[model samples]
Target chain A: MGQTNPLRSARLGSRATDQFYEDLRQGAREGKPVCWILGALITTPMVTSLGIPWVFADALAAHLAARHQQKRPEEVAEEKGYLRETCSYTRIHMGCTLLSEEDRSKVLDWQVPNPDFVIITDGCCSEWVEWGDDVRKRFKVPIFTLHVPFLWNDKDRDEATNYVVGQLKEMNTFLEDTTRRKQDWIKLAEIINMGRQAQDMRAAGQQLCRNIPAPATIFDWATALGAVFNSWGKPQSVEIYKSMKQEMEERVARKEGAVVGEKYRLAWDGMIVWPEFGPLSKKLASRGANVVTSAYMWGFFPTLMDPTDPLKSIAWNMVDVWANRNLDWQINHVAQLCEDYKVDGLICHAHYTCRALCGQQLELMDAVSRRLDIPAIFIEADVGDESFYSEAQVDTRLQALLEMIDAKRKRRA
Target chain B: MKAVAGVDIGSLTAKTVLLDLQGQLLSYSIVAAGMVNRKAARKCLTQAIRKARLRTSDIGSIVSTGYGRSLVKFGDRNITEISCHARGAHWLMPHVRMVIDIGGQDSKVISVDSEGRVANFAMNDKCAAGTGRFLEVMSQALAVDLAAMGTLSLTSTNPAQVSSLCTVFAESEIISLAARGCPTVDIVAGLHEAIGRRVVSMVKGVGIHPPVMMSGGVAKNQGVVKVLSQLLKTDILVPPEPQIVGALGAAIFALEE
Candidate 1:
């Protein structure tokens, strides 16, 4: 947080976020019809263009709960008889809508706005289907769900693209009926182009990390890349990426890295512990070890899309999202990142309750280490839940890993 | 000779080893790790110093290891038990390539390089099963001395099976086994087997390099060692004083500096 990235200016960072939320709250207060959009398949630009406000329930709930030291939204879901084993992101997002009025009033109480409608996509996690149902029940809003099948093999790529394209057409019709406005193809293509530009800018910024004494840390990527998820199709999101890319290029030219000494370059392959981000980053900085790349920060940049074909482009992008792919794809993708970032070691966080994230991680770690000939450390931590984290446990484990890296580097020298 | 000390404040026990500049063992002390880890660490180190007929100032450097390592405020540095165990086990048995450390709160399998550094390692998740806590709880349920249960379990004609991996559930299973009038010896044998099986699975994940050795307090259990060796198809080596391995590793590290 201490002067890591110049891209994170007051306007593009916290102030912009505050204003965005303030606009949403104003929308809700004015009885504007709010549409709830699932993460990973965010259609913010589509809804924004229609003069409709969209809500990302999980992001709002997670940020508020962690910042205000209130009961995590996941706890609320558990109270409503959702099993603790449910994905934390989905549970917390669903829990935000389920919070009783009185209970919501006591906490940071950022209520999930009463939705005019909710949209669910065939997102990476299987839990979104159930999350959409919960949103429907709690808010009593009509729900639109999209089904996008897995796209791993090249053989079925065309079929998958067509299927998603068809769904997008149906979604367009649904929007027209709901808002009584015809779909604007030209405007949509422009938005898609902006989103594509933002993706390229962000990727270029991340590529800069490959340089020695990385211009940005993994935490910086996590923070700067977040807007891509929530607001990517907008001009503001594109501007954020533009500023970030410029700042990173300047840092590289001036020879500045995230950590002071920047001795050990590392890559992380898991979600950051959002609640403990400050403490964890500080600890790493204190030891002169910085995470230059993170697989989680690699946004689903739809590979090589034709901007003229908006629906097909969106479909292609959805399938390319990191979380939606098979383990082999993930391993190879992360291996490329490790090589690109010039990583000395890899740290894989096996999240406590995240089945998708934890699946085949041991095998992934083994394969990556073998391929890259670098040491990998597998640590157990809960990304969203602070209750599962222990400072003593993490500190000892990390100290040992850093020592191992140090020993390996010295041996190499 | 300059003296150095390694203090390991684990979940259940605090162990300290005093070593001379040549890395020769000077004296050692072990004490119950009570609630106050700092107190336990101080108590063990002081006892170790007295036994060696040296004053506190005689100790040049003190390195701490284990869960409570950070609580040793006087420590010159702290390292994890994973690295310490690998170093200590490799130091004691140079040919040893793997270290299975089953401590009070956690159990870990460490693969060590030829130069006695951590190559790779795997540890049990955030659970109490397959750890010293599991053995302690089972010994209590069986109403046997924690030290003697291992020997008594070896004499069992039929080892009862413990199906639960959770320590809490395993205790209940042990309780029900006793209620069913099952022989305490057999139940204890089965409990050891359960822990052995769990540890062996973890070892297999990190991969078993020979010769394998057992460290931590759990290594003292003959029943666990016998079952684990049979399961792994490899002889599990235990040091002369198995519980002091982590502290010994720390002392070796202190010696190097």
Candidate 2:
């Protein structure tokens, strides 16, 4: 019940996230162009390298949920026709954006400024497109949508590549026209390479976890996702991931463990309960179990691209994020992660509202479970809504999983 | 010289099983939890103690199980119903590798190994579609006695189609069918078929290794057992007193401890 042992560099992520907001507010304070990129799509090197500070639309919503302040934003969003059953993270985003300046002041210790421009990268679902249109109307700002197609390695792969390249070019032109700043090709390439380096380092840290007494738990990596989320193109990510990798390397050398008495090593397959991360991590640690690897913990590791060719690089990242892929791809991807991590079991946090991630979890769970010869459990929860989670139900399911694992260990022994 | 006890406090009922030093059953009792579950567990334990004619001090160990296991303050240990049911069913029928336990709020299929250890399990804890409460709601809608619905199901020549994933909605659907002159026997049969199909889906996920068995209050319903056995294409074993299976499992753990 104490803080999870092998204390990770969790504060690094918190610092990175805080610095992200500060940089955005600094852009707003200086009256510079600040853009809002909705969804995890292709809105990257072009905007950030142009000296225009950008923020992911749902970033603050995730922050609020982690800090346990989702109630007020949710209430406000509900009053404005956003239902609880429809993505609480989006509802909170809409709520904060729609709030009157005075009301927003009352609800916040800080603020997210209205964007000077909005780019809707609606590849995975139609929700982001609608959210983009709504924000465009509200701010009356210039908006561009890169219609990212969902085919990376299909027979029509070349067509998908050309389609995204054309859109990315047009979007770059649109950005140049809106901000009156010429595009910098060399600088763009430099940023992509840096992001590649950072992503590679993060991936390396994850790979080192194949060691027994895994040097890092998923909590360490999941918390530090802010580096990948906020500062991928910046030197900050390189430094953050470098330190992270060094810590993991040192741990691996010393044969130190992230969990105190780690008896089990499992992997998480879906979105985390951000607010309950500490409690959940501690609870698992108390049981001598460590969730050493997770699907989301590596950030953009699996979305590997040709960093030398920047357009192809961004295009691949834009199209192949796990959210946009089909079930077959997801099942194989999860299976590969389990094999790489050598996990004993899997826990899929089936967030009720996330149709994109959890849509095929049952089939994925069954297929991967049979293929890998390990058991997987599904825990029902929502990304940011604590009220939607059932603590007792989750506890019972997890306990049973541990029992099954124990039986397996006994049989092996 | 000493006896061990197991107390199972479920959503709808609490059961207590007492065992003598030789691991032989001494006595057991079941009490409806009503709205006050903790009180029900105490009363069930008290009745079992009286029947066994033993004082509380004579019990050397107690293991509590089921949904309300956490509320049993005097319990030496609390185990999940999933494990309890698996151990109990496997003890009763040594070859039983699967158990279908339908409690008041949830239903679960537990796969057991040869040694009575849980190999795998899947639960319908998110919904009440295939649980005892689902049948109870339908029986109330049909004006049939809770115990009589099972017998009536066996007489259903033409079982009606009752397809609603939700228990509350299923009740309304049943009512509409009854209004349209659909027979209660047919509807009861439909309910049993629905629950049987749901449990089969769960069992398949855990990969059925059978000598399948049924346990819990719903196991007393012969029609449900018959339907479930037919659906799985295997003869199912039911303990003579199935309601105390979880408590029995817990008592086994207490005895071992």
Candidate 3:
């Protein structure tokens, strides 16, 4: 999946992921104040403005898992009485904390240094706040918690955004105090503008996939997202997205799909199965199914962020996302994607250990299937747990989806 | 272009079906899917071709299906067993709105529309619980013949409790019941009831629309069917030869090809 892609950003994205690891290791050696944060609200601007290194806990877990290096971390977490049912990313990150000196050297590619402080948000799930508190206790680090209310009414959007924006102001003081450096407000504005350009380029790249033969597969976007997520607000991210958008334009002009024989255009939900990423992509491409879009990738990245009023814009973007809404919001979100992508089927990865992310997958599949009149399959997987993945199950379910699509085509004919 | 063939290489058996130009079943054969399913696929297709008194060259197209569908190198195309089972079950009983396929190593419940197109499907995770393999293992542990367990269970007055979902644990639980002087019929009946409960619960979760047809190797077991029928509160329909339905459906597709 990696080498086969003609997209330059895919290659650069891999380098960007590698650079992320290198930067973390170098930052630790230099004793930079690193904060492990949950919720995507403060990741980009906070790190860029303060001129300090930061760790996004979930991203590191995904990095570790993708490298086939999460086994010992899982073992350490399980030994510490963290049930396998607890989020695998949480276990992987926490297990990194509990790793013995010998195990850490063997397991981790780069040392995951202890955080100077913790940032927790209940915007997505309360579980993050609890996991954040546990991290706070483990290292005796202070925890900064922010509350973003769940919205059932579209009218509550402004209220939630305003509330979260107020908290972001307090967060600036906390960052300044933790790092003993003043927050660079001017730098924050610049980074936020840069992030907006990057997001637009990436979104434009994704939009090109609505073509008959999708010029870029979701795997292409998902692969490059490693760099995009690692450096969302940085200059390099803008270049990465620009390259990706250009590749999509070139491929569409040439009538070349990332998947050679695109047949069934499908949408995916839940976390990407990081451990089996390449093989998963290869297998689907073999079946002529170009999975063109995902709710996970589409919903997580902010579509719009006001650089002028950075916190208010980020807060508004955060509250209106799929993760923060009810089941109805999620159902409509995916249905709209299906129509937009011309997707005839859906694959909802029912990640086994994702308590926060996976509860409504079955219901989501059912509602979307009925509402959109498309077939949906929920294949069991764990986002970071390689051992929990079953190739047979994945093969059977996805094959069934293709067959369903074929049958529908026949009936229409 | 007078006939088409379908080969289904499953976990336990490889089956092949041949259909004539008029879309009538000509002949079919089932053989043990040995360690090499590729070999079994070849043998099964050959046997079905010969049984129909037709040469290999007569097959207009070959569609392979089941878990080992990819291994059928001669297949012109391959469809997953889920779609094949739905198509085949509908061909056999057109009114069926659902098909419950419990094979050797896996089980799935497929919801279909009035026209028999697949609407939705749910399958067990990578586990052998609620499948024919579980019964085969339990029969071995209880020293009961696999085919006769169904009849013997029908004679039980009070069934023993067999609650473990894992095959090994369920085997141990049944053996423990036997150790305590529980009747073998009671234990066997309990195994049927347990597997019935497990599979029916799955069907219920998928929201069963009835006129349900049961297919795959497990359909041959009367006790499991009887128990499932009771739990689902619907009389289940079973084709004369259940395991060949997937291959039958594939052959149907080959006719269209």
The predicted structure with the larger DockQ, 1 or 3, is 3
Compute the lDDT for candidate 2.
Answer: 0.82
Give per-model TM-scores. Answer: 0.94, 0.90, 0.93
Q: Candidate 3: where is the Cα deviation over 4 Å? A: A1-6, A40-44, A100-108, B1-3, B34-36, B53-60, B113-116, B157-161, B176-182
Regions more than 4 Å wrong, model 1: A1-7, A68-72, A302-306
Sorted on TM-score, best first, the list reads 1, 3, 2
Tens-digit lDDT track for model 2 on A1-413?
A: 22366545655877888888898898889999888888753466778879888878766677788777677777788899987887777877877776766666545634777888888876876778877887888789989988878764557666777888888889888999999998888888888888888878777777788988888888887778777778887888877778878888888898888887778889898878876877788878878888987766654635665557888888777766776677788788889988888888889888876777777788888888889878778888878888777777788888777877876787889
Tens digit of per-residue lDDT, candidate 2, span B117-164: 887788885666878788888777788999988888999899888787
Sorted on lDDT, best first, the list reads 3, 2, 1
| Residue-pair clash count for candidate 2 | 0
Model 3 lDDT at residue B101 = 93
Q: Cα deviation of A390 in candidate 3 (Å)?
A: 1.9
Q: Please provide, for model 3 over A144-231, each residue's C-alpha lDDT reduced to its tens digit, 9 standing for 90 to 100.
A: 8888888888898888889888888888788888889998888888988888898888888878989888888777877777645678
Off by over 4 Å in 2: A1-3, A6-8, A99-110, A134-142, A151-159, A301-308, A323-329, B35-39, B136-144, B153-161, B171-194, B226-234
lDDT of 1 at B57: 91
Clashing pairs in 3: none
Q: lDDT tens string, model 3, B3-115?
A: 99988889889999999988899999999875437999999988998899999888899999988998889999888888888888888888999999999889999988766
lDDT of 1 by residue, B19-59 (tens): 99988999999999755379999999999999999999999
